[model samples]
Target chain A: MASNTSDLRSPLARARGLGSAKDGTEHWWGQRLSAMALVPLTIWFVFGVIRHLGADYTAFHAWMKSPFSAVMMILTAVVTFHHAHAGLQVVIEDYVHVEWQKLALLIAVKFLSFALAAACVLAVAKIFIGA
Target chain B: MANGSGRPLSPHLQVYKLPLTAILSITHRITGVGLAVGTLLLTWWLVAAAVSPEAFARAQGFIGSGFGLLLMFGWSAALYYHLCNGIRHLVWDAGKSFELSDADRNNRIVLGAAAALTVLTWIVGLAVW
Candidate 1:
């Protein structure tokens, strides 16, 4: 009963999230998980590209129509870009000196990454679903 | 943590001779950035394929151009390096290969693997089509 009254930590301190300034471990682990997933997917992708070298749109369209390849492509796009954004944020935080410039770049990178991912997903869907 | 004392702001890169581990660590970040850029090109190719054969051809033509091919080659090199170094990093994450000797050997292996993989992939690409 006395321990409750004697506790010194403020509510703000008690409620503080985690890791360097309340958040980071999760982001760190996110990069690791995504990287692990990408290892096989990237290898598969490289081989797939090699197999399709010089093949025209018709060939690609045909190959991507398979639910398996289409799904893998989508997953790769999402995880890779998310991982890229996370890594790039740290790079900018480390290097970019000007506050506005860093903020602008961080925003731009996220926008481009997410936009590309969305477009890739839609494209894969269009081909996979024949829509 | 800050007083107006004449203190070093940060460690200068030029002062110290970087070891292979440090060099590869920096390369990891550089390739990470390069891959982010390379994804845009991949995205374009994918969208064009999704659009029409003509559009895809146009995309292919650009990518097949000499300059475009060079860029793609560089991108591929970055990709291979990043992926290889990434695996090395994951191994470190498992709390292995932390010794300086291990760092030296493993980092060199990562570089060699990246180079070999890049060249091999291109060769396979050329032979296939």
Candidate 2:
């Protein structure tokens, strides 16, 4: 086992040996940390959206363009995607039995979350910047 | 040994009665996924706003439609449920409320609070709308 030439396992398989990744706590802690941040942020978001209910485009756009709303919107989007990805990763791991498919889905989730978060930030930034 | 084939498996989901705590535990995950899905609507709304008034109006029009309103209602309920249960989880993380009775009671409390909050939100939303 000590000699690389004697070992037949592929690098990926060797790296994926059945042992603790030693980073499990990162996922747990991140979920909790983001959940805490989201408590107040989600509350603020719910109330804000309700307040804007039935408002015209100009009115709604104005609210979205406001400084506080813009900042909170970006914060909410970023933290939310982070938290959501962490969560969906666990769900996928638990349920997806096929290894390759699970890996592909996990990668897709991460990429989709990042892309959506970026789109959200750009939208808010564009509106708030008025350009 | 690598393959799990021909082995007696443990009783699966429908094999036993689930307690309230267990149900809510799974519900937390369900709502978490639902909220993740709901985020797409949020993104669409924002992107539409950034695009133009016309785009925003179209977005608003769809959201005002019956199907869209139903989705919003479901999303809000899921949000409140997730929020309340999430706080309960945070408390558990702090090493409190591990008692079975406490967990059971908190499960009811979380469900009741989520329901009340959801109803109150829609009431207020419609009133102001």
True contacts kept of each: 0.85, 0.76
Tens digits of per-residue lDDT, candidate 2, B30-84, equal 9999999988998899898889888888888888899999999999999999999
Off by over 4 Å in 1: A1-20, B1-11
- Residue A34 alpha-carbon offset, candidate 2, angstroms: 0.5
Q: How is the predicted docking of candidate 1 categorized under the CAPRI scheme?
A: medium
Model 2, range A1-131, lDDT digits (tens) per residue? 54689777667667766334745467788999999999999999888988987677779778977899999999999999999999999999999999999999999999999999999999999988889
After best superposition, candidate 1 residue A33: deviation in angstroms?
A: 0.6
DockQ of 1: 0.74
- Please provide, for model 1 over B1-129, each residue's C-alpha lDDT reduced to its tens digit, 9 standing for 90 to 100: 155687755655788777778888998998898898888888998999999999999888888789988997999999999999999989989999898889888877998999998899888777776
Could you tell me the TM-score of candidate 2? 0.87
TM-score of each: 0.87, 0.87
The positional error of residue B128 in candidate 2, measured at the CA in angstroms, is 0.3
- lDDT (C-alpha, whole model) for all candidates: 0.88, 0.90
